[model samples]
Target: MFTLKIITANGNEVIHAAQDPIFHQASNTITFQGYDNLSNSVTLGEGLTSAGGDVAYLMGASGATLATWRYRQPVQCGSSLQPMDC
Candidate 1:
């Protein structure tokens, strides 16, 4: 099972969860850390995002899938609240 936990800065447990992957690819590697350089600044589980990669030994993917759901990058809003459009 997949597990997620949110901890307080002082080392307290704020939240936790268990989940399962919709898909898995064995013998696959994640070559890229994110969609693009802009992805570097974006945090996981925040805002619109894209992720996939093929590397040496590690292969992992998160977020919704086409079979279960669909997603689109939002338009740029040019505001501090959201740094990028999507």
Candidate 2:
């Protein structure tokens, strides 16, 4: 497994697993979850997927970007949906 570090414009950092990090994706939105560096708890985050950009902004609870990460192609997993395969 790999880690995705999201760095915001204001310097806030959120870390997430690179695998299966994207919880939801739509025509214009991509929703995800990660751990806040300060709290170490899972925080809900979102990003835009409409512009076909390699980078996406991860939004915080206040609707501001807490961080950003480069988009990576996801690998297909087997029926077990194990992390080792995804």
Candidate 3:
């Protein structure tokens, strides 16, 4: 099962659009980090903004942290997905 969860810093949750291709990629990459980020920033920029101060992660079925989800990148692309609109 692919799991991507985003919980806000204020104790709220950010629900992902499951069918969104952006999320599909985020949920798939297990070794994502740094410049190789599995970014959700594009989604966040579009309208997925409840995740601003989020505690987000991509998890494996065994409950390990595969990757951490990033919410936004002001003037750049945070991942291999769509580039952030500048």
Best by lDDT: 3
- The collision pairs in model 2 are none
Off by over 4 Å in 2: 21-86
> Which lDDT value does model 2 have at 53?
34
- Tens digit per residue, CA lDDT, model 1, 1-86: 22223222233332212233222222111112233222111112222223321111112235322121112223445442332333
The candidate with the higher lDDT, 1 or 2, is 2
List the global CA lDDT of all models: 0.24, 0.41, 0.45
* lDDT (tens digit, per residue) of candidate 2 on 29-66: 23433343221223223334443333445454455665
Instruction: State each model's C-alpha RMSD to the native.
Output: 15.9, 11.5, 10.2
Specify the poorest-scoring 10-residue window by lDDT in model 1.
23-32
In angstroms, how far off is 70's CA in candidate 1? Answer: 24
Candidate 3 lDDT trough over 10 residues, lowest sum: 27-36
Displacement of the residue 59 alpha carbon in candidate 2, Å: 20
TM-score of each: 0.23, 0.27, 0.41
